[model samples]
Target: MSTVDQDYQLPGGGANITALPKISLHDHLDGGLRPQTIIELADDIGFALPASEANALGTWFAEKSDSGSLVEYLKTFDLTTAVMQTEAGLTRVAREFVQDLAADGVIYGEIRWAPEQHLARGLTLDQTVEAVQAGLDAGVDDVQSAGKTIRVGQLVSAMRHADRGLEIAELAVRHRDAGVVGFDIAGAEAGFPAGKLREAFDYLAKNFFPATVHAGEADGLESIRGALFDGRALRLGHGVRIAEDLVLESEDGDNSYVSLGPVAQWVKDREIALELSPQSNLQTGAIAQWGNDLIDHPFDILYQLGFTVTVNTDNRLMSNTSLSKELFLLSEAFGYDLTDFEVFQLNAASAAFLSLEEREDLADQITEGFGRA
Candidate 1:
């Protein structure tokens, strides 16, 4: 479409992953801004970025995010978030985010961002949501005008370290009819467990709302357990470490065998989706214990064990990636073909926080597209 097919051959040539229909389950809104857009927004607000040139600013984000420390990686958001404190900035960024996702062939996506982080400009939390919705709506309209349809939902996030979980959860439910789809608790997950927002999760549950918590990435089984029990999360954000519960016995040439402990069994049995960001996982050292390279990721193992694994670009600009790029990297590392790639999309479609009808429609769209590919 944009002369960027995102398709690439594997060691053994076949279909390119970029031409395949994709669903992005874990992309972040604030983390995916264009470098040029950042420069303009920062300029409009009289704000200074780490670099004046867009290319230099892009390099700055990449460098900071790959520092292998969660706190250091998170520092990049400070600059991105700094420019997002106004209505114009929020709307423009949101609209552009969707347009870019559409360009990447992501038919459906869920964008998560913290609203509390955008109120520095005197806008109320509800006002910030409205501004972002305006942008997202514009982006959707832009897609339709281009003869390509893309749908997006906002997973309004409450910074876990802050005490505004209940308020943000209510904000999400208040905007439920207006593009806001789900609730999430993101931020430093090590010290702040999902249980910290027990009141908020309980409220979401009572209202029949859905949540997806950032767990099992910074913390361990206890955090994941809390997300399931306390947060009542329908899906796990980057729940890669659930593989830590997997115990391997042996593997031969033709076949391999392994056993799942209680945690792993429950996750698989319950069919919780894992939003695995391959490159982000590698950069953040999330998979450091397994290996340094992409091949060392537990994604293939989780997929083989019947876990609902979905591919994502947790932060596109910072990781210098797109949904297509992540798929290409995965295929290169794991020999994935069209069928394997389609399975990932199907998994994401099923895990999307959407109505049964919408999910089914998305599944049909994915299935039909993949059929053509």
Candidate 2:
């Protein structure tokens, strides 16, 4: 319904990517706040920032995240979370986040954030969850009032390096009936394995709750193995490194052959969704073993191999990107057309943590929108 869809379009005069319905999974709430919002919240809390102006602060975040290390990329969240300690800051950011997603034509989204990181201002875990839920509800109402339809859910995350996995898991379960849909474990994937959170995973499994683990991004195949076996992850966050399990054998004229290791085969066979973020993967050096550019990304290989691949903007503000922009860049890189884009959206819709009927409705909405475009 937004008329501001002229910015992103397919090559060769095809449909505009921004106007197409989309689904966003693996988007982080703390990583998507506006730079101007950060400045205002920082001012209210008397917190010092690296840059004074909004544009400069935005550049600062992008620059910091481009350091080619996941640890360095994660340091930018400290500033965003600092201002988000209070109720007002959290609500405003969540509201604007959903509004931005709707304007970009996202019909459904799941926002993941670690509640334990926002407890600096004397707020309990449940209170933080309530504040964010209130904001998400308000944002949905705002979108509906503007003649657009959008739905959002929360994926509560536990910081892997911290010792509160069970606590965070319990917090998520407490808010499951409200708006929380699933659970996730994020932060520093190499040294902190999914096995570290076995108790948390066990509890979620016992309660029949779904989970998605951050693996194969900062780490390698063993991390992914743990994510699948120990964490029992239904979806993988930035699972680009699963490509490591692929072995290139030989290539004849116009023909190349490759073999998948057991882990990669299992993931592909089981239809586990891979939440791949192109720009963020390049920035964090998650695909550095392949090459430095998007063309070198294994997304194409995985897609061709029948893997369940879904595109995302892992940290939109940090990567200076949106879901539309990410899809546009992938199109430019891999020569994707409207059909390819539709497949990506369909994959995300199928992987969403919703009832089968809800997913079918979302698929119908997506098909109708794409058909009209």
Q: Which ten residues in a row have the lowest lDDT in candidate 1?
A: 1-10
Over the stretch 149-204, how does candidate 1's per-residue lDDT look in tens digits? 89999999999999999999999999999989999999888999998999999999
Where in model 2 is the C-alpha error above 4 Å?
1-6
Task: Assess every candidate by TM-score.
Answer: 0.96, 0.98
Best by lDDT: 2
RMSD of each: 1.9, 1.8
Q: Cα deviation of 223 in candidate 1 (Å)?
A: 0.9
Per-residue C-alpha lDDT of model 2 across residues 283-308, encoded as one tens digit per residue: 99999999999999999999999999
Please give the lDDT score for candidate 1: 0.89
